[model samples]
Target: ENNKHVNDTENTLKRQKTNKKGGPKRDEVWEYFIVDDEKNDRHYPATYYHCEKKWQKGKLRTLKAHLSNECLQCPENISKFWRDKLSTELTNYTRKQKTIIQLPLKQYQITQHFSSDKPLPLAITERIDRSLLKAW
Candidate 1:
């Protein structure tokens, strides 16, 4: 029937939208994160996210949605690329991201009360300066 054909066409279009070939996929939204490196260098993750204050406050059961980094740049979307191109591009990103030396990811938990909209506190800056002076 014509209706059946139309339905099939619609489904195909939906699936094709996410396929990584010759077109943009709308399924996954990209997120970038600024992860801290071992030597105080900052490396960004493809998707960066953390627990939200509301989640901690018990008002919300889940953390906030993932947010992209301000400076984190996303690589070009290479939809439907062949295996060889995919491998080469991946290797390039890995190689380019390497610093003087590769550093292990350090995971630490801190009880900092911060909201996404709030800026860093003055006291924190002062403390950082004081700590640096002490090191000097």
Candidate 2:
């Protein structure tokens, strides 16, 4: 019985840790818009406008866009602050993504001749190139 109690306590702690790992803390944007419980679908995140009371389905960035670009519910001063904050965040994100995508790998250098045991056919090579480009 004592061993079972100790096991139960350990199991509860493990469950709590797993639960905490599943969800990150809510973003600050949640203060402006609230999840629309009535209209929310499990597959999508939904929020309602304060002024219009309309339900919108989108990710956090989409909500930020709405506040920064289209929403008229907030007062001029608050709206301007949010717009500037979101704009700065977007600019930083764009710069970071650009650097990550543009930076070339230093470890792998191209050679004049194919280093593989057998060179891939031209058709297969072109297909792979196209697929990678499309993926990016």
Candidate 3:
């Protein structure tokens, strides 16, 4: 009974660690893809579209681009609808992200991706350049 209790406690801890949410809500684009239990790997669905084209998971941007703008396999009308729908949804999401009023640099952090472990340099004179300012 003591061994059983220890095993149960370890299992419970594993479940708690793995049960964290996978980030934001599922996007509408997922509706178009088929979910198959037998074919699905641990991370991504085996097939990408209802048409059963091969695609990897965690490539949401690529998936959206294919469905919204470039998939010839999907019916033209469906592609057209998604193009409009995705465009509107992305626009709204961008607007919402832009409204976060934390700090001047917070906006930059929100828009940019930086995964380096190295600390930032003490000074960044490039930020003051006219071309960089205009681009931003």
Which regions of candidate 1 fall more than 4 Å away from where they truly are?
21-136
User: Mind giving the per-residue lDDT tens digits that candidate 2 earns over 1-136?
Assistant: 6875675566456535544655566466655544443335432345533464444564677766666667777667667877899878768874334544667756654553456767889999999999999999
Q: Which pairs of residues collide in candidate 2?
A: none
Candidate 3 error regions (>4 Å):
1-24, 36-43, 93-136
Q: Estimate each model's TM-score.
A: 0.16, 0.42, 0.41
Instruction: Give the CA lDDT, 0 to 100, for residue 28 in model 3.
Output: 54
Taking the tens digit of each residue's C-alpha lDDT, what string does model 3 give over 1-136?
A: 6875675566456544544658655465654654333334444553544455766563567677878777678888878887897888777874335565766553456325774666556465454565687988
lDDT of 1 by residue, 86-114 (tens): 45755887434555766797765454544
lDDT of each: 0.37, 0.61, 0.61
Best by TM-score: 2
* Model 2 whole-model lDDT (C-alpha atoms): 0.61
Which window of ten consecutive residues has the lowest lDDT sum in model 3?
34-43
Query: By descending TM-score, how would the candidates be arranged?
Result: 2, 3, 1
